[model samples]
Target chain A: LAKTTQPISMDSYEGQEVNITCSHNNIATNDYITWYQQFPSQGPRFIIQGYKTKVTNEVASLFIPADRKSSTLSLPRVSLSDTAVYYCLVGDGTHNTNAGKSTFGDGTTLTVKP
Target chain B: EAGVAQSPRYKIIEKRQSVAFWCNPISGHATLYWYQQILGQGPKLLIQFQNNGVVDDSQLPKDRFSAERLKGVDSTLKIQPAKLEDSAVYLCASSLDSRLAGRTGELFFGEGSRLTVL
Candidate 1:
């Protein structure tokens, strides 16, 4: 499992773009970067995942540099309801045998202000 | 489709007592997981089950905590002689499959069972 580091908290205003970065210096070759968002009293929801370069989805986008040492999650036009905790995890998603046991860090708390 | 279902949304018990939580995964799902979430922290995986079989339980406190997923559908987690630190939300999650492309590890989780040890 690759250890990940992220900001403890971030503040942003509505309609502004928000970006959260995660560092995983020890990421493995087969590891994939995954981001999850968790609202208050709810389970974490998958937002985006990528192996390298950039991957975009309707909800968010993930950018992974060639070095793979770090990655960033970009949220466009943030809203008050976007307030939640975001977690970045790096693991071998190719191996389903033990994927469910992946570790989750404390996560970054995003506060979307009105 | 109905998401994962859990029971007894809240539970209160005294130290040294026993408590149990139940979960029902989405139909046809093959992987189930039990996680513990302490306030202000991310959820910790306690156990994982793959169709009535245990996959990973390295983090589970076997001496006091035990879980079972019989018939590959519903599961139960039990704690004996609970302690103060055991007070947390117990989360149950399930995925259609564990394979990489099968579901990309996307998990559907229940509302969770909040336990308070007094």
Candidate 2:
């Protein structure tokens, strides 16, 4: 399992774009980067995932550089509802069927203010 | 489709007492997981089950915590002589399958059972 490091907290105003970066210097070739968002008293929800390059979804976008050592999660037009904890995880895409076993870092807490 | 279901939304018990939490995964999901989330921290995987079989339990405190999935559907997690540090939210999540090619490894989670050890 690759160890991931992210900022402890971030603050943003409504309608602003927020970007959270995660560093995994030892990421392996088969490892895929996945991001999840968790709200108060709720379970973590999948935001986006990518192995390399950029992957965009309705909720967020994931950008992975060529070295695969780092990845960024970009949230567009943030709102108060977007304030939540974001987790970045790296794991072997092929064998991580039981994704629960993947290690979860402390995560970045995003505070969106109106 | 119905998401994962968990029971007894809240539980309060003494440090030496025992408690149990139940979970029912989504229909057709082949992989289930039990996670422990302490306040202000990310969830930690306690165990993972592939259908009715245990796939991994390295982080589970086997001496005091145990979990089982029967008939590849519903599951139960039990804690005997719980400790103060055991107070946290117990989350249950499921996925279609573990294989990456077969699925995206996206998990559907239940509301979770909040446990307070007094």
Candidate 3:
């Protein structure tokens, strides 16, 4: 599994855009960049995933440079309800024949203030 | 579609006591996982099962923690002689087998079982 590094915490005001970056210098070719959002007392939920370049979804966008060493999760017009810890994980989503997959880092706690 | 279900939502026990958590994944899902999440830290994978068989349990503290998924449906995670550091939320997640053609592995997580060992 590839280890990921991201900010410990970030703060954003409502209606502002927030970007959380994750660095995985040792990412493998088969690894995919995935982000999960976890609220207090709840299990983490998938936000978006991408291998490279950019992928946008209804909730957020993921941007991966060609180097694949890092990626960014962009949330637009944030709301207070968006306050939660976001995790960036690198793994081969196409296969799961092994254990200890989807290792999550300390995660970036994004605090959305009104 | 029903999501992954886990219980008892919260548990409090004294040191050396034993506790168990149950989980029922969505129907037809073939893969299930157990994770432990400490306060302010990301979740750690404890075990993974594929169709009633253990796929990976490298991180499971076999000395004190045990989990089983029978008939490949519902599962149970147990902790014996609990310690104070074991006070974390146990999360259950399930995903379809990615080996299936055109399927991408996506994990569906439950509300998690919060455990506090006093």
Top candidate by TM-score: 3
What is the per-residue lDDT of model 2 for residues A17-77, given as tens digits with 9 covering 90 to 100? Answer: 9999999887766668889889888888878888899999899998898998899999999
Cα lDDT tens digits, model 2, B1-118, are 8889999899999999999999999999888999999999988989989999998898899999999998999999999989999999999999877754534567678889999999
What is the per-residue lDDT of model 3 for residues A1-114, given as tens digits with 9 covering 90 to 100?
667899999999999999999998888766777888999989999889888899999999999999999999999999999999999887645224233255789999999888
Give the clashing pairs for model 1: none
Docking class of 3: medium
Better of 1 and 3 by lDDT: 3
Interface residue Cα RMSD of candidate 1 after superposition: 3.0
Task: Name the best candidate (by lDDT).
Answer: 3
Using TM-score as the measure, what is the rank order of every candidate, best first?
3, 2, 1
* lDDT for each residue of candidate 1 in A1-114, tens digit (9 for 90 to 100): 557899999999999999999998878666788888899877777788888999999999999999989999999999999999999877643124232334788999999998
Per-residue lDDT of B24 in model 2? 94
| Candidate 2 segments whose C-alpha is farther than 4 A from its true place | A92-101, B100-103
Candidate 3 backbone overlaps, count: 0
> How does model 3 score on DockQ?
0.61
Kindly report the interface RMSD of candidate 2, rounded to 1 decimal.
2.9
Of candidate 3 chain B, the 10-residue stretch with the lowest lDDT total is B97-106
Candidate 1, residue A82: the lDDT equals 96
